[model samples]
Target: MTASDDEKKMLRASLQSMTGALESVKMSKANTKPRVCLYEVIATARDGLLRRTKLSSDIRKEEGHRRDLNHAVKDANVNVKCKQQLAFNNQDPAQQDAIANDVENAKEEVITKQLEADAQKERVSSLYLERDDFNNALSRMLDATSIVMPFVNLGEIDDDMLQVGITAQSTFMQFCEDWERR
Candidate 1:
């Protein structure tokens, strides 16, 4: 079966409404936008952490391997902090270059990963709603959240934003495990 034209129209209308709401949210705040500007937050957070970690790791690797494993871990932690503070800096958003390509690719990957992450989150959210999966959602959420955000503030963590991030992480993890896909 396929969606009827009415259903298609309704879907488009729903999307438009959400987009409008997003615009409102974006315009209402600046830095805050970076934090709470997501409905599918678990996926959003996974992408953010992935973005922070990947960038940090790449930079550290280029700077030269850490002297010891402990130092490497420390360096990795610091790098994530640095990335959290580092906003999309380059003035011209339109500008493109070799390094830009890497960042662009990373951003793209974040999208793909988040899509996977979101699918996972949706599964957990459904489980939580139905109460069928029992503690499955909670466990999945915790494991996934830990993978991205262990403890310690990367930078500025608002309570609400942090909570959302936690929920999102758990949801994503639950789905990943449930689907039996990496």
Candidate 2:
């Protein structure tokens, strides 16, 4: 039982009208403003914090090692002085020569330990600079994202706000892509 031509045309007109109405409603519901990629920003912050923590630990260990090396240098210097005093008191040529050799070896040890301490100090300084950089980078990211609501915490945000933010972000990205295509 096929419909008459007039009836088919009316049905087609009705369907087209309904489709237009639906399209209008969908367009009305579209987001107008852009959203921030909150998830990505959080991930970046977390990574930076982890790296900063590791760098802090490294700095502490390096500083401790440097202090130990400094103490070793001091002890070596004292040993050299003691050997020199002993050589000064001894009259025997052979004993004096042996003490002189001991003093020279102790002096060499002091120099080696001092060099190691200096290197460790340099490493600690570098780590401090690296950690500072990470801190500055994290601060810049937060500033750029406008996430600096001092009293507001991310965990306190409701699920609906998060969903809306994500949707807005997606819409904003699409808009950018579309604009670029032109």
Candidate 3:
């Protein structure tokens, strides 16, 4: 009876320890869930920042192109006016006809440049919409990160560290299961 009592006490103590350890593991898993979510939010923000950078560069280039085309249109219009004035002043019908032809060509160039500028304006408008979309997404992500940041400590939550921790937890649980079976 004395030996049996000692064995029972030892078994109860071991069982209590295992239960405590399991509870600790459950808490760790709960904590890890928020950490993983925060990490994903951060990763998405980084990707969005990169995309925004590229988009900003593209917008700047397109805006520059639009400006140049608009300037060309203005210059072409001025050229048409000058050719028309020359045609009016010239007394020679043949020379006036040639100048008139030049004036018409200059008008056509203005039309072409204006069309190009319009296309670029449309492109810039579309790019602005795309940029706005990214900004909105990033803003929402920032809001989420702020909300969860207080709850989750990201100090040791790097990708490799996170994976290793999860793996270790799984392995430890497996070991516990095997020991229990034994």
Candidate 4:
């Protein structure tokens, strides 16, 4: 019914969309066929990465807007408090009523803005979590592909080769985790 309510609905929709996208990427990783070409795998990973990047950008933008709205809410609260105090100390009944009305209106506006900002924050947080999930899935796919594709291409389907691939994948994943920490 209200603008804030509409904004909350939009935020929920965005979060659902992002979650679905991440789930799709996870499905793709799970269903990857050994016979699939390396190029296609790379392209799929690239697409996931690009989507994650876009989500990150959107989260940043929403964070900025949320911060601005929070500031506005604070200003509005201050204005309402000032008006209320003035009304309380006023001598004229008419002037006091007018100031009280202004304070009430400001309070309503602050509540609406606060609700919008909170919804934006929720959306941003959801996007960040989804982006992280997508990134992790993509990294695992790339790491596995890097280690396994070589042996697969060489037609070396043996226990020794599988062991080597697993070792390489572990080492590569560890290196990546360390690099991220730095």
Q: Output the number of the TM-score-best candidate.
A: 3
lDDT tens readout by residue for model 4, 54-160: 77888888889889988988998998889888988999988988898898999999899899889888988877776676567667777866776776666543555
Q: Where in model 1 is the C-alpha error above 4 Å? A: 1-96, 132-182
Model 1 RMSD to the real structure? Answer: 29.4
What is residue 19's positional error in candidate 1, in angstroms?
84
Per-model clash counts, in order, read 2, 0, 0, 0
Question: What lDDT does each candidate get?
Answer: 0.51, 0.67, 0.74, 0.71
TM-score of each: 0.22, 0.62, 0.68, 0.61
lDDT of model 2, residue 151:
15
Model 4 TM-score on a 0 to 1 scale: 0.61
Residue pairs with colliding backbones in model 1 are 42-168, 141-170
Give the clashing pairs for model 3: none
- lDDT (Cα, 0-100) at 153 in candidate 4: 64
Off by over 4 Å in 3: 1-29, 154-182
Evaluated at residue 21, the lDDT of candidate 4 is 99
The local lDDT score (0 to 100) that residue 51 gets in candidate 1 is: 42
**Candidate 4: segments with Cα more than 4 A from true spot:** 1-36, 149-182
Tens-place lDDT digits, model 2, residues 5-115: 999999999999999999877644432112234655455556656766877888898889889988998899899889899999999999988888998988999889889
lDDT of 3 by residue, 22-98 (tens): 99998788667757655665665676677679889999999999999999999999999999999989999889888
Tens-digit lDDT string for candidate 1 (5-91): 999999999999999999877655643543443334545455545644554555455334222333444545555444433434545
